[model samples]
Target: MSKQSASKSNIPLNPLAFIRKYDELWRRMLFLIGALIVYRLGSHIPVPGMNPERLAQFFDGSQNTFLGMFNMFSGGALERMSIMALGIMPYISASIVVQMMSTVVPSLEALKKEGETGRRTLNKYTRQGTLALAFVQAVGMSAGLISGGLTLTSGLGFYIPAVTSLVAGAMFLMWLGEQITERGIGNGISMLIFASIVSSAPGMITQAFTDNLNLIVILLFAVLGLAVTAAIVYIERAQRRVPVNYAQKQQEGRKVYAQQQSHLPLKLNMAGVIPAIFASSLLLLPATMGQWAGTSANPTTLQSIAQNISLVLQPGSPLYLLLFAVFIIFFCYFYTALMFNPSEVAENLKRSGAYIPGIRPGQQTKRYLDFVLNRLTFIGAIYMTIICLMPMVIQTSFGVSFQLGGASLLIMVVVLMDFIAQVQAHLMTHQYHDQTLIKSSK
Candidate 1:
């Protein structure tokens, strides 16, 4: 109808066009790329004092266990015993601890209610926690390297330097992730993890192909990969829309506006890849401890217990699968609850004079929302469980070495979707700004 609206409607929706027009968006994208390059480079810089041949031999032997998975997440940094061997796990673990504490700790809960300032305080605590964790893990890793004969030099002299290097590297990575979040595109931590997984892809694929060398098997895996990717994209986009009607109100000029209808979009997987990551990290702890115990010449009672626990929890073990699914389901509900508070949402809706159809404004709305969320979480948990277990199942059944399955696949797919969504959002915002400028000029 109007010239402004007509011109706006004619604007191209193409991503390339937006990138060409918006210098800031392109700059952010470049920054993200540069940050990822730095991370990759760090992943290749091995820590000093380790014998490269012995380290490589150790990882080669341990490739099927928890260490392998850690290596995958670190973009081969663990196998290389890189300066970044610790990767971002310490930060993730620290975040999990902080978030879990927020539920039970009154002070933290109060801080949470304080908003941005509180968030900053909590983040400071998380970084401190990360540093602490990095120190402990670095000590363990350095000691392990010495005990396993992977280190060319031994004693406190070697240990001290190695530990310091790992801890410093981890802290640097944490800082890099934060900077990317502030100055680049997409979520920085997730993007880093995504980059790690993707960096390992070419090698994994080549190894798998070499091991199998069956054209049929290769084709089958290719088809399955495509299918899984499609499934992930479809489910990630799926959401349940809860309709709400806002009551009409009179303005300063005494003009009454008509009631407005809108919908709240609740995603199927509100927790995203967090639950899976949490579950995997928890599962890895016992296995890692067990691996360390196995290296001991004389084992104590505690070490024996740890070894038994690790044996029972190998990746393809029945017990491992069961516990993994349970943890995933538990975290799905736990994290979803933390992220989306039904009571808060209901309160906000009520304050805005909005109501879900056939539901009362406050308590009833909360109850209904909780019910919907629980059901959705249940389905999401099942979906995540299946996706995560598929790799193990395929390995056990088909004897295929499909390393890039399950949690890695989910992270890659989800992060990619989020990245694309962020890019599109920037493009749309730029287009809107351009339309406004055009209207003003007219």
Candidate 2:
């Protein structure tokens, strides 16, 4: 082998090493850490007119319901009735709606094909949707606060400020997430969610101690978390490789180049945590409105229907679990379909003179790709469903308060894995630049 190849092989693969060597990577890491700190700090700033004592009491009684899970997502902001109590869910819900619509709506689909300009247009629509949803949710939450006597005053005096604060807070967080995506590592929204989940760790630990959980049980829970995380790492890394062969071509007079071979790596879980995240956000929105209605002193017919729906879908209900699984499965297929087009892939491959082993280049290849993707998506959906349901099942069966549920755990693991992968990619690029510099000097 050449000296260049030998030196390239000798380069270290450790991300930490590159982090120490490269200023840019460390700068991005620091920026991410600083942004998350800002988010945590904002969670402590309560909304005006909130009765802190009553709010605390209210959330204390709601430790096992949908409120509890929602509170966890907000990093205790909801429990405190803070300015950021709404968290990022409004934005997520709006995004889901916009994306799903884009798939079916002719005008939206046209914009989607228009590329970057279309992306900005779609994003503008999503922001508008976020504002609308946030306003409606804020109004409901304000009513609940008044009904529960968690507010300092009644009527429009409290209502106006509360709604304004909540909506503004949600928009601010949306902007912060955008900044993080532009300037930091990993996805901005996922990182924010991850930060929220992790920020609650100290409180969860205190709760465990207060409950007098035994060392053995604590160890068991730790083991369980590790096992789940390990499983996610394994499955997230798994891929199906489809072998492809490129046809040989004549370069000049009598010189024919050798045929080339490569493989397309189709992930076992192409949708990743998106399906679960989307399903959770969609499921929780109704429950939030229902919880607000249930707190009302006098509910209207619409509120009554919402409350009944909430009651039926209360955290551990069989219907909740079944619907969660079904939505996850649907989104797994839906998101996968949105991201990958077998016809497009087949067309590209045919143009490039590449064909999958034993498969024709055009329509047959598309069919084969579709068959493989459907099977993969089916397995992925089932795997995500089982992993997401583990915490609920454990809590219901053993009467244990597993505050860090399976869904949150799965998201954290997946986000961290993706972050690390991005870091490694950065390091690889740096290595390539260094190799080029070395060769140019030689």
Candidate 3:
């Protein structure tokens, strides 16, 4: 037993053993790596008629603004004005909008119940929305370039082609992400974002060193990072398992099934990193407008108001942080409510003859579940708020510019945990298949 336990413990530490044993796992992993490589390669290809040096300079000064966050999501593509500067944000935004609408729109709500076919239809709609968003954003970026004097050509010659390139790049990424989801190991869009964050880490570290940060400060930052990562893992794995009991039942042939015990597991963080991402994306809208408005030689009154709004909401500012927290908390409850329905769970449990101990089935069970979930969500909102704000606090205190923000770190850690979980699931499926084969042979 001791030897078996030791071997099992070592499995995760050395994934190479599993890679060698599982052909499908390795092939999927290889495909994922190749797709990310393709994404990184595209990040280096600058758009036509844009000044790369000027673009880099602009981003360098704008690192404290929303543009910096945008660049980070693009794997530094925006810094170079690369073809993929828009990244897959348009798709993400479209997805969020579609999901919100699905709850309110009767047609979409009905489609949500149609299973796989419905999912395909919604994905088509998301793609169309992505296309529209990408075009609008690309046009904005082009106009910003012209206003900021970052473009080589003045007229429609540069505008049309630049917008086309940006839109195409975004669409390509959206397609690539979908392919990865179907053919690769993890969720394609998340994996792409993970790759982007990781690819940019070395540069961030190098920049820290070049900034003459003392060893002690660097050590402190490293310690904080490790602490945050550990906390994330712990909280992510935490769940409240509600005990359930199934009553014995008899079939027509006098066959009786024994009573069964089970659990309904409620995650501490039902929303994951989505709240942070959504809040950031929403906030970027005003900031992007301000960025363009500020560049104009003679700004209109509304533009000036936008510029003022942008100033108040610049990343790391008190107002920005407050709004960020509010949005994160709001979306946490909103998304959790969207994804989980206590009434449905209660109904399903009642139908299956399962009931929580000491609690009546149906409405009572739903109310209990709702109470539990609300408390869990409240705790989760606070936890996420801290995790997403800690890095900014550290940066402000130390006066050090750490390229990794709280949101970025949370996304990276959560995505990696999810990837590992998927791998483990695949492994279990393969093992189950092998065992079935052995049983059949015997």
How well is each residue in 1-442 modelled by candidate 2, as lDDT tens digits? Answer: 7886665554444465545558777788889999999999999988899888888888887887788888888988888888899999999999999989999999999998899999999999999999999999999899878887888998989998999999999999999899888888999999989998998877887787788877787787789889999999999999999999999998889999999999999999999999988888888888977887677667778778877998888777899899999999999999999889899999999999999999999999999999999999999999999999987787677666646778889999999999999899978877887676557545
TM-score of every candidate: 0.93, 0.93, 0.92
Q: What order do you get sorting by lDDT, best first?
A: 2, 3, 1
Which window of 10 residues has the lowest lDDT sum in candidate 1? 10-19
Candidate lDDT (C-alpha), each? 0.86, 0.88, 0.87
**Candidate 1 TM-score, true structure as reference:** 0.93
Pick by TM-score: 1 or 3, better one: 1
Evaluate model 2: give its lDDT: 0.88
Let me know the TM-score candidate 3 reaches against the reference structure: 0.92
Better of 2 and 3 by lDDT: 2
Query: Residue pairs in steric clash, candidate 3?
Result: none
lDDT of 3 by residue, 39-72 (tens): 9999999889997677767777887677777777
Q: Model 1 segments beyond 4 Å from truth?
A: 1-21, 252-254, 296-304
Candidate 3 residue-wise lDDT at 390: 81
Worst 10 residues of 3 by lDDT: 433-442
